[model samples]
Target chain A: MNFILHISKLDKYFDNLHALNDVNFDAKDGRILGLIGQNGAGKSTTFHSILDFIKYNGEITWNGNPINEKTFDEIGYLPEERSLMEKATVQQQIVYFAKLKNRKANWTKPRIKNWMKKFDVKGDLNSKLKSLSKGNQQKIQLICTLIHEPKLIILDEPFSGLDPVNADLLKQSILEAKANGATIIFSSHNMNNVEEICDDLVMLRNGEVVLNGSVQAVRNQFGKNELYVTTPMPKEELRQLPGVETVFVRDNEKYKLKLSNPDAGVELFKLISKGEYIEEFSQQPPSLDEIFREKVGETNE
Target chain B: MVKLMNKFKAIVQETYVNQVKSKSFIILCLLPIIAIALIVIVGLISYQNAASSGNDDTNQIALIADSGIKKSIVQKDGDSIDSSIKTEQQAKHKLKNDDIYGYVKVTKNNDKYTAKYIGNESIDGGVRDDLMQNLSLHQNKLNLSNNNLTSEQIKKLSNKPSFYNYVKSRSNDNKSDDNDIKMGSLQLLIYILYFFLFFYSSITATVISKEKGSKLVEVIFSSTTATKYFIGKITGIVLMMLTQFAIYLIMLFSSYAFLSQADFAKSFIKENSNYVHQIVSNLFNINLLFIIFGLLLGIILSATAGSLVSRREDANKAGQPVFMIVIILFVLSIMFQNNSNSIIPKILSYFPLSSYFFMPIRMINNQANIYEGLISLFILIIFIIGLTYFISKVYKGLMLQNNNEGWFKNLIRGVKYR
Candidate 1:
């Protein structure tokens, strides 16, 4: 797939402190690119630079031409800070945002209405934004960002403060954007959603890209032959098996084992049979959360 | 340019509509009416008390003296004089019965004259002073009559070379009095105007800046040029102010119409009836026009400054200098009018802030001609608009800039920093 955006040797600094150092990245149309990092690891800084939040050295080109700010007329940005004018009404605010994206009011209003309805936000067009709950306000902001049908959307922790149902609702909306031929840049601390949606991703540490690629490929690239078993057995009994490097008990019913080779699973099967009949055995890929901890050594896990 | 202008018009229309519909805008408009009504009600009560205080203006005072003495002390606008009275007891009884406010009991005591006066608690200061002066004059006349002074001599004594002053210069006696009143009124008007402007613009500026502080500006900038958005935002706010002003004007007009028939109604204006006709001739004065224009300029310029900051708190801080400058100019304008034709007022009349308050007053009294006021007004307006444009440019640049930059440092960098 042809890359929609390419950034190379991109650098930024704040006085004596180097903020973004020689970052290299790529993204394609119709894809969701996840960005993961610690609180201070420059994920926000990168998104900001793309949106011209800061002036930086080096180049970030869109479709081979340098990304000019004027091109933002076709882009939507949802900042993680979660901001909106409380004084304005829901429809007035939505229309204003849509206007910024070059949409006419007559055309924009109905679309915002449809989005609000789809999200199950029941309210009149005249309801003040301040009266809405935190979750509902967030939904309004999301609707604002998504109103313009932008080609490129940057959502910085858009899932924050959302309940699981709302989060799922937002995820589906994002998938809908992808289906509509839009490129989405998603930055977050939550790995599960990143695993769920991101076709490719990068983990940054100390303003430098540490790991990058498709989540599955990257996990396998940093492979440790690991097996997670769910069996009705005690952890002490599983720990005594040969070829099992160690057994980490999740609870009474399930256990995770690190293996030296693919054949090490046979030893787990024998242990399972001796103690309690094995409920199930399957070689599952390491969760993205686990892989991130091992690579970045982040303590979030 | 036309495209941009059209966009600006659209923004302005939206702003005006929204602002007029806003609760705050409605309140701002209603405040002036409420204030006027309250003032009128309070004024009516005070005027009633004052009008009834001295309703008995016909009470007579007696002077026990000669027939010619009555002729010398006869008041032109008062009741027929009481020619003579016997004693002080009669005077006290007359005062108590409201037959007389007071009376002077004159008695010849050797060479020098001695007099005793009786009055009630309700006696006025002007009447008492007049009575005392008349008694002294009567004593002088009696002394002259005893010396067998001729009528020609008395006439000569009365004419003490009264000076009738005249001047062809811009400064003249009558003009000077007019200048003081004009200056004071002009200064107060400009101050009120500036206060209203600041109140309106600062709130809008705060709202705009909050968008940046809250990251709303950044999100909007993602889909449009910051310059366009900033221009649109300011345009919207100004339109709102205009709407508020229009509503306020309508309310004032209606209130005036309603009050003009009342007994205590002092017209719809805080000015003399002749002011409307008199102000016409002064309208052409360049200096006067300049001063008014300058004041308007100050409002616009200060508003532009107010909008340049990225936070509501920052706008308050940034707006202080502009506000102080407006107030200073307003004072200077008043000074210019009060000290008409003086070196200080003359010089300040050409100054940006000082001129708006001074010109109208000077022009009305014919202290300064129409052309001078108008020319000054035009220049001041241009200066203020230019300054506002520059400030707007700075605001546009900083709207998308890293808000972490401190206000003073960012200002020093001049809207662009690598």
Candidate 2:
């Protein structure tokens, strides 16, 4: 099924503060959409609106229909603040949450072992959640979210407190869920993770959708202004090149340059290469991190 | 609707199982039984001690009086007097030897009787009173005989009258007996209601606040609506309460059955069989409906209070208002329990908050009719329904609110969101 979650001009006000203003986005099936924002940027508010957990001034529809109780059964949400029943065993917690999502305990029970192995969770089924390390507990929470096989998965800050290995495990699981034709939408501060996994991206700033598109398209819109070159070119020489705005030394022989325009990249590449062998010469759009800071920094300025 | 109900059932099952399996629940369930067993054991031991002490010969006293006076006074088999010590000299000798507890002397002078009790220490108040009554009775018999009255005439003059009470409001022939049973049942029901309300309200509040504090409500709300979630939670706790009550009832009946096999319990049951039947009947009447509704109100209100806060530490503080209301109503109910016919209690009998306390008391006192009880119950039911609906509406907003704002501010914010 080609499931799609559509939000249309959603607006939310908390007392005198406009928490979300005319926010609009769509998350399609079999794809990962990353919602990114600085602190207090209404990313959670947008998720809340989609989940129908709060009162807002717009409509959120799932597959061209209003989200309802049955839709909720097909939807799984992992909240920003990770919390599970500390007193419950891993199996009990997973089964309980699965049951809430309309899955039978027997069905969830057998799958727990596989998920434990997949996530490398170092606890047995009967181990209490509190007995596990923080990373292992988060893995258990992730298992709870995906065990029901929800078609629409909403995860808020799923990778906030994970080591690189654990984060890679979660990333693999998210991609697996996506491959199974689930609509996965997650919010994160890790721009690298977002850039790596997100097929689509929505950036919110001060309760407004500042940027929205596929990850490649959003990054490409900023042009290939960033250039990394490892050559004999000194920093002073790189700064003197036309169309090069700034020169940054990354290593003993490497230099990174920011172009004032996309056309500047071609000129810069030609100058750095010079029909000779260069160890590294690459020009690409600015990283999502830079774009995020620039967009969020625009407001601060 | 089926899916909604399924989710509701899931929530209820989770809550019920989680709580029923908790150490606190197990401890609470066993606490009363342990306390009851302790009380019974202590009571039996005390009774045995008293019974054994009653037969001590040294604890006995001697009564020395003229033969005419002694013959006129009637004595029971267990009277503390030793008939063997017939003279003052022997009585004094026994007292000095610590063989007797005391000695009493009786004499008549100028048609008046006087008694003197002598011992190393004062006699028991009960023994002294018994001796004084015996001397006064002998004096009365002598006075009547001296007034030219025959013995039969004196006996006729001393006959006591029979007394009975008749209440105009009660339709039963055994009004006083029924009233006694109802009064006793009313107190028991009130105590149960008070205890269950306080206990279950706190449980409901803690359950909600814990979820809120742990930030697990969003995941829960995603699976079900707030109304269904609230109803499911309250229903789950109510079912747990019923299960606990059932356990207690089973324990009570089992204990009764075991005790009934004993000779003392069997005789006691036989003596108070009518009272027991009446009390059981009264417990299952309309008053029970009031208690159920009253408990539901308390639990629902406490749940609302619980939702008003975003942290577990604030849960007890949030519940304080509901607890205060319950405390006030309980106090008022007790104060007006005997004054059911008074205007204040009559007025309170119809109010939902106080009616649970006053209506049952008035009905037992025959100051309120069955119709009034039903009306009060109806009002309570309506109030509970309305409050439940209102709280359910604001529950989502309350659960979503994460501000450190105080409860009242959060409540206002939640209401606005609703």
Candidate 3:
């Protein structure tokens, strides 16, 4: 069962402000799609439209049919602003949310311990949600979202408050869910996490899809214009070189060069290494972080 | 449809279980019972105090008069005078010893009589009044005989006219014997409905606002339709209210059953069986349907108010409109409970909000017929259904909203978005 969530020509208006404008994307099964943008870039709006939490002008369909109540049972969502019933114990909250997704408590109950262990949650099942730290409460919320084994998973800022260790644990769980053929769409401000985990990426800018493709493809579209080299070459000489637009010393012995044309990378690599073995020499397209900044900066201009 | 229903059932179960376990719910449910118990305990203590004080000999008064006058007065007002104290000296001795509450002395003149009541303090007003009336009557008898009036004339002059009261209504051909009891039961029903509407509506509003204020509603809305969720939540709250009412009824019946075995309760029940029957019979009728539908309207409107707020702290303020409405209906109902035939109450009897109070009162007063009650109930049901639908339409937009806009502004936005 390869489930695909296809959102096409989606438009949403909040009074006079256009929140989402003809946004289009697809999240395929067994893959994680990262939605990346700066603040107020319509990433949350896109997720809201997909979940049908707000009215939109276009169609969002699961597989071939329109998303409906039955589809919702197979879908899991975690809102950007993390919240859970503070008065409920961890076990009760998880079971209640799972039940809302149409999963039985008996089935969810036995799996709570395993999920708690997997997420490395610090609190026990009976611990009140409010008693736990913010990170632990988020972990419990994540467990609730995923416990029902939803075919379509949507998470907004799932890693915003997590420490490195907890973030890694969540990353592992997300990958595991992906391996189980879940179509997962998550929005995040952390480019490293997106680069490390996302199979595909979509960048929204002011309610429009500015960039959308597989992670590599989206990056490759910008070409391999960034170069790193560990050389004895001075920064001024590198700046004067053909196709070298800018050069900056990155470390004690390392230099980073930006190429006006990607082909300039081969020449720079040859010149920096002099056909000899170098300690570090690499040329690649800009990172997701740089691309995100470039795209957002372009819109800002 | 099955899946939708399943989700609806899940929401209802969750809402009911969560709220039923809350400290607020438990406290609210027990508050009335505790209050009722306190009242009963206080009443019992007061009654016992009165009974014990009644048994004290010092609470009795003695009268000093001629033997003939004493006999006539004792015959007129028995148990009032302490006949054992026959003379002023003996009464004074008993009073000095704190045995007698007071003493009254009667003196006769040529055409007038004087009675003085003496004690350590002022005599009991009731005893003083009785003594004065007895002395005056004795004087009247003596004067009548001296004036040469016959015994038949005195007897005829002493006789008083008889009087009786009756109430008639269009519903009953005969005069109503239990009008007072029926009116009392109607007032009681109105009060119960008011509490149910006010308390449960506020609860519903708070519950909805709590979810909306947080991000929880987004997650919930994703799993179910807004209509289903709203209906499920209202159903859950209504069921909880019903459960609380059931507990009250059970407590009441259990208390009754337990007390019925006691001699005092048995005699009381036997003495007021007709009143009890009237109260119980008033509870089972088309008025019940109006109460239920009226409660639904209140809960639904409060839910709408709850959905309009962007934060949980605003929930109480959001419920104010509904609270004011309930208060207004209660005041109007009480004001016209007896004057059910008036045009204002008649008009209000058909309106959904006031009908719960007025229709029952009118029916109990026989100012509204069974058909009129049923028609009012039908209108209320239709109003509830329409309101539920309208609120459901706007509920999704309202829940999704997260702004600090004024409630009316938000409501307009919600309608526009819908």
Instruction: Go through the candidates in order and give each one's C-alpha lDDT.
Output: 0.69, 0.85, 0.84
Ranked by DockQ, top first: 2, 3, 1
> Judged by lDDT against the true structure, how good is candidate 2?
0.85
Best by DockQ: 2
Candidate 1 lDDT: 0.69
List TM-scores of chain B, every candidate: 0.64, 0.78, 0.78
Please give, for residues A49-95, the per-residue lDDT of candidate 3 as tens digits.
88777778999999989887788889989998889986889998998
TM-score of each: 0.77, 0.88, 0.88
lDDT of 1 by residue, A204-237 (tens): 8778898889888877775556777787667776
Candidate order, lDDT descending:
2, 3, 1
Q: What is candidate 2's lDDT per residue for A165-214, written digit by digit as tens?
A: 99999999999999999999999988999999999999999999999999
Worst 10 residues of 1 chain A by lDDT: A292-301
Judged by DockQ cut-offs, the docking class of candidate 1 is acceptable
- DockQ of all predictions against the true structure, Cα-based: 0.39, 0.75, 0.72
Model 2, TM vs. native: 0.88
**Model 1 C-alpha lDDT per residue in residues B1-418, reported as the tens digit of each score:** 4433443454555556766777777777778878987979887888788778655533567665544544555553145335445566776676677776677666667545666666664444565566567667777877787788789988876786779887754333466555555554555455555576467545655555566667776776676555565566666666565566568658866766666666676553434434433342333345333433543564455444544565655755656656666666655655554467777777666676666655555564467776787676776777776765766656545655545455555555436633
- Number of the candidate with higher DockQ, 1 or 2: 2
What is the Cα-based lDDT of residue B207 in candidate 3?
Answer: 84
